[model samples]
Target chain A: MKCARCLEDTAAKVADAPDGSGAWEIYLCSRCNYSWRTTEEEEVINPEKRDPYFTLDGVDMDDLMVLVPVPPLKK
Target chain B: MGCMPACKFKPLNNKRKNQGVNNLYRDLREFLAKLEEEGQLVRYTDEILPEPDVRHICRASGDMPNGPAVLMNNIKGYKGKRLVVNVHGSWANHALSFGMDKDTSPKEQFHELCNRWDNYPGEVKFVDNAPCQEVVIKDDINLFDLLPLYRINPYDGGYYFGKGNVISQDPDEPDNLDKENVGIYRMQVQGKDIIGMQALAFHDISIQLAKVEAENKPLPVAIALGVDPVLSFIASTPIYYDQSEYKFAAALNGIPQELTKAVTSNINVPAGAEFVLEGEIIPRQRFPEGPFGEFPGSYSGIRKQVRIKVKAITHRKDPIFENLYIGRPWTEADFLLGLNTCVPLYRQLKETMPEVEAVNALYQHGLTAIIATGNRFGGYAKSVAMRVASTPHGISYCKNIILVDDDVDPFDLMQVMWALSTRVRADKDVIVIPHTPGMPLDPASEPPGMGNKLIIDATSPAPPDSVMREVRMVDRMPQALEVEKIIAELQKSAGK
Candidate 1:
């Protein structure tokens, strides 16, 4: 019902829900366009399944850091 | 100390919020729809449970899509709360939220951001208590009760705070000092009394946290639930020790970000903020924290973490909890916070290092910076490269830095590497200094912030007395006309 931040205005929608259930209202001001993605009341959010964080070892940071090799210079 | 001038912005309540998905809601919501329309947001209404296994779905999809946003409608716990995932993870999405073309380049966007932030309002106001205070959960607080705090990745020891901003005060400075700073630190929830907070060593926030520990004092901080979006950029904005986020947020918002006195401690919270966690880090409260995935594309196994005593919990009647995932590219952490702040940094670097031409937050803001400079002499590119990895604006977020010459686009690594391969001789052109320093999440280095980094100079070699080449062909007119037709055709095809 109430908004976060200003806590004055009413809430409308959720920005990002890890779980599919909880309501994360989009906090915004009708005037300044100061908007953010947050969930005020996260009763139960069904977060999407993810991989093991350790899987990062499966790939090299260098490889991921550099998506493509920079080509050599031209004449 | 002065009030920030006003801007044309207004909250998107009645005018922007609640509009039909088709009528086009605010910039952020519309972008969310675009992600759906583009099939980027996988509408997973699957009957999923809130087990750590839930992370499998996102990992199974490979890396998150860079162009379109991701939205999951069906969830297991807290059925009343709706969740939206990965909204500001890529440049495309962040651009759309701020009313820019999805394809807007980082160089252009960062320049605009610095300018827009300059107009940020600093005049602050306050209310006794706001949304975050609406529902008070004092004392006997158990964060697990805030369900859905599951592990986001395989390496992660448990659920972590990857995207949210951790607002803390600088302890080295006087409590009431003018230079109060607030930074976005990764708070990985380790246990009931402890959360692993990765405050980069080079940063002031971490230093302050250390100071409190030195004297065995609890560091009080407010983890904002739902405040304003610009606060993210503000959190990422470089600070001069103990600089109040309110001042920077005020300037960034083009109006003062109102503050409310904390009920549990002597901290100021944004009046508009949703949930405010009034907690203190008991000195030397250490625990095993991570093994969580980070931007450097890796996760460091469990390590000693910090402690945060939950003194009070406040939020709106139906507060929305914000969370994000790491361990891969295209997370909002990479997009909005990473690349979002790159170009402006390149521009800022130029004031001190003119040779610095361009910089970009590539692969989700992990350094990978592509620069273009006219390296006139020996070490010209090296000096510039070093600064890229060490400067508060540059090195603070970099895991790997690649410096190029004027000919490189900075946006295109292919161009930068081409310059490196040809112009730079391995030992001569490449500058790899170990312990280059970076974020704690960079698992490749020493623990978190204590690590080394490498910088490769990809600039072209200077001419020995300069030999002339064949006369270049100038086809500007034809090129412009050809590009014009392609743009027109694409616009018409997309029905724009």
Candidate 2:
């Protein structure tokens, strides 16, 4: 399977799923160095992302939020 | 009305360095600009409620890598004013506030903090004119009508200054920083002219108040809000009674803190503060204070504490209101206290066992820790672990101590868990201390200030080469890179 993030085909089985039924697979792109969990549909579809002000509580977002800079104080 | 010209020290270079930061920013605004420069500050324009939305944003951003401090400019009721929260919520931000690179590790940060403690000298220089005095209101003032103090939680007693750092001095020695006490105490707005302050019986401020009360004198205080981040961290730290936080702040900022007299009291306040509440806590009076959310993720039930009778309110023309929210594990309070708390414990352990590599405080109020050290003897691990569990004030509150070998990274949760699983024997490694000094906010403490402690020696007992649990290591180039390439291929094969 191809990586969802970088559209690369470097996917492999990382571990067995918690129920031992579905195997957990991960896709890592060498170009951008982005890693995605293939077994978890959320990380693939709606991966945790930072908002300008808030991230939904209880969700661990991977990216740090970027803030707009205000005018600096002078000496 | 303004700062003295002589105290205006030049701002230091912003370049990343190893020896620590040189100069403190001029004021809170300049400090916020520095956080913005480092990409550690975030702004929210959403018209949020006063209760949970603003607090939720702080918790979410505060739990991240170098915690992005949140600035909420669009509150439901307050339009022209801004509320800055979680400003010191990340490890990287903590280092940045004190003049270190944003990438400095906890161990290196600790070393720099200690070095500042050793060599930095602090002085409090008075100024004549200050911004905090730009607008003074002494009469016909109602707190609810004048300021936008939010009720963060449902069961909170009332609106509060969650991040107000109180500055008080010994009545006898009112001018010296040595007798000055600065601490972050929760202030519940009890009325238009009064606020209930919780100075826990164990705090130095409480001790100072007790001394003043014996002589039947009101302890004068100045509550400072929206000061620079470095001073805020210093106030939140569990500085020893004899050590002055103001001096330490000056040292960290590389200049003397500009002080100005409060309108209602003689106590000196940071001249650059956005706002200052001048008041006095009467000697024998007590008022109902809390039922407010505490740092330990629980409500500190109602108790009668000291009451501050606000006599004057002074602030900058267009002041920004600053706050810190309690409750939950990884909020700003935890990060602020965690960074400073480790320094004291390190000093305590290093006095005898200089082999201690580093200490990592975990969760709210540092209730648990992972200590890295060299196991010199079979029982040396337990002995050091005992000191970690029993040390007074800040770290003594750390009830769970996990001792690991020097090779293990204390900040890595998985590595700590692995050490616990492999090196620790349930019966042999666990040592329980029955009764010890405790944190009042801990929900599990039996008598509120007393609790049991557990020390797990996670260090290996086997010889260097002989290991009980076999471990497999992965190489970086072919094995890891090939896995990444495989995952990329898999994602590509899967539909868009």
* Candidate maximizing TM-score: 2
Clashes of each: 95, 29
In model 2, the Cα lDDT at residue B457 comes to 88
Task: Give lDDT tens digits, candidate 1, residues B367-412.
Answer: 5566666677756777777776666756656656677766566766
Candidate 1 chain B, which ten residues in sequence have the lowest lDDT sum? B1-10
C-alpha positional error of residue A74 in candidate 1 after TM-score superposition, expressed in Å? 60
In model 2, which regions exceed 4 Å deviation?
A: A1-75, B1-20, B63-67, B103-108, B394-396, B461-496
Docking class of 1: incorrect
TM-scores, all models, native as reference? 0.72, 0.75
DockQ of 1: 0.04
Choose the strongest candidate by DockQ. 1
